[model samples]
Target: MDHDVVLAVDIGGTKISAGLVGADGQVHRQSEVATPATRPLLEEAMRGLLTSVADGASPRAIGLASAGPVDPPRGRVSPVNITAWRDFPLLDLVGAIMPGVPSVLVGDGIAAALGEHWLGAGRGVEAMLGIVVSTGVGGGLVLNGEAYAGPSGNAGHIGHVVADPAGPLCSCGATGCVEAYASGPSMVRWAQSQGWTGPDARALSADAARGDAVALAAFDRGAQALARGIAATAALCDLDRVVIGGGVSAAGEVLFAPLRKHLDGFLTLGYVRRLTVVPFELGRSAGLLGAARSALPTAQFESPTPA
Candidate 1:
């Protein structure tokens, strides 16, 4: 059967979203559900989700965007939040569901970066980084008009980059990682430790918006850590722009103002100093769009096109 669209799936710790996307990157039909807890349930959920969007039309290819760490060369994934899966053969499972269609997988950060570069905030930029700052800090890169996932598909993991050797311990067992300070939970934890009694990142943002001193201080600290990571990345990759998104990024100036301020101080190199940081325009749909883009034959990095 000749196919007119691609099946794009974005799998995160909290939710799984699937959609039928055309070559133009428009999502025709989409649906999502909360992530299942166990491997069996998760598999079942994915099958059902894909089946729903692919009801009648034949998909040219299946593209998956999953939370890291992932092995794209092996078509496997083991996201930190989804403890039920470890080296899960996600590509094989998608192949099983749709027999002959080609399927490709990429890290969520890579997908977001590629998607932003294609049609969002970083469009037309020569080199850029896309960042997600929610539960954890995540990043990906687009260089010279191409998405670079590296050989291991873990190239742009800026969150794991050390920001302060003496800072807090990270979930990955690293000390003072960008994630340790800039993640939503990290910022909240710092505020709480400082006697700012916020229940969550949302509350912390609200407090900061109201000019609460401790909450503001918490964001400042997180911003400084994030700035350190961003500066390093920009310097190393010669990035021209950065697009930041995710739940915490919605805090508006509560995050960007301090981030830009700290970034300005950290970026002393002339080439890296001109890097423009902007908010993502695609909101939560960047991953889905990027997955779809990856499936397209014209994508800079893609598998063999099906006939």
Candidate 2:
């Protein structure tokens, strides 16, 4: 018999990916396309992708994972990178594509965290934070083995956590946000300001790996800011682990080494000090799988630890 699956879609600034996923987090079919610059084209692409991936198979449900800022309850999204979509009716599109199928909408950050909690590095952890550090930093929470999307579906926005009172301005019009320092663009911009000319975060990461002083320093600064953000989130939530991903995270030890060093200094409390940080295991697949998990009618991640 064919495996029962949900239609899972992950919509991002650059790409729109769709997959048919089973309850066990296995993807049976998948496809992706570049996100169009216009809303009409985007809608058309999404419709075609969904239809192709589904292949006439009626999904048990639908899971839509969208980049924030998202209104999950209302199935609307306004991703900063995707300027064409402001308060876009994403779920309505899903509904129109597959009428009568139950659907769940979640922020991409939340989906990443839920994916990690369900099957990735956070599998056994009771409370954890999953963060994405790229052109922008985003985060989501899994508390007591349950995804906590909060009232606005923006609960674990750790990127906005303040790291310094006198730091650079963030895209969110705030000063000293972790994103102002740790995001890929922020790191590259800071490196450039210091006379370290690199094309992008990828180049910076390469140079940092080669022991270039300026590149290393950039990573160090970004790492410190990320450490502060992680520590703050851990303290506030009493977290057990943190899973980091996105483009900047691929810097590996260039980022992780400094982050670990700085995190130790910030996490002084005994409980908080025990917080462990790890790389995201599922990578890009996390969002799709997490969305599928959300669509599961009775899905719940029961913690091995006692409540």
Candidate 3:
């Protein structure tokens, strides 16, 4: 390693992105590829991306942020989106890729939160909720100026929080989860049930932008469910800010309008009323930066306990 650079990895179901982040927290070079569903193909795709991104520069440390169920005590990760990686030795494998370099593993949500706190929308907040509302809902918290991943390193799973008792069942076999109502597919499904006939959330957003009643109602419903979760999170954590990013978040005013309205309705407590919610500042780069931040040495940031 020539300098204190971080080899950051952002692993998701759709893709795996790797970057060589310099000491200043900027990614100088990066590479990404589709995530193969199978084990062997996944390994090949991931390794190639890592090698390509390194670009002949050895990194001092590696930070990996993968969708989880991170086994902190075992250094393995079982991302709910990636079925091939059930308790996969991600930390060990990444470390092995650059022998003698230290590696850190954390949940993707937690990584996003850390990244935001350091260089994005949550830059100045003491308590923040960072959420991703894409194919699924995922979230993490930075409380009292430190990332809180709990004992097993998967604490801020706000997506699974129950927003309505009468809501539909989630893929995790539970009913009334925030994800069941707020995720892109969930909103689309609800719209379809109401005879909207939309093919996907993207089209739904476009229709909503044109003021289609049914599409607007679909976003409204998802916003309501998301509101419940956000309000509850604020109440519990006394949050100062909420930053949301992902594909569904791109709906802009169509989603935020109803989200703010429902959030206000649910904010019965005066103390939590001032919480600010906004779009993610870092966008697609947040996860990579957050993963890189995990390798930096500072009290403002901390890594999940090694499994």
**Which prediction has the highest lDDT against the true structure?**
1
| lDDT-best of 2 and 3 | 2
Give all candidates' CA lDDT scores.
0.88, 0.87, 0.84
Q: Relative to the unseen true structure, what is the C-alpha lDDT of residue 51 in candidate 3, on a scale of 0 to 100? A: 72
TM-score of each: 0.93, 0.92, 0.92
**Model 3, C-alpha of 206: deviation from truth (Å):** 1.8
Q: List, residue by residue over 169-263, the lDDT tens digit for candidate 3.
A: 98767899998998898999999998998799999999999999999999999999999999999999999999998789999999999999998
- Those runs of model 3 whose alpha carbons end farther than 4 Å from true positions after fitting are 298-307
lDDT of 1 by residue, 241-276 (tens): 999988899998999999999998999999998899
Which candidate has the top score in TM-score?
Answer: 1
Give residue 85's lDDT in candidate 2 (0 to 100): 93
The local lDDT score (0 to 100) that residue 52 gets in candidate 2 is 95
Ranking by lDDT: 1, 2, 3
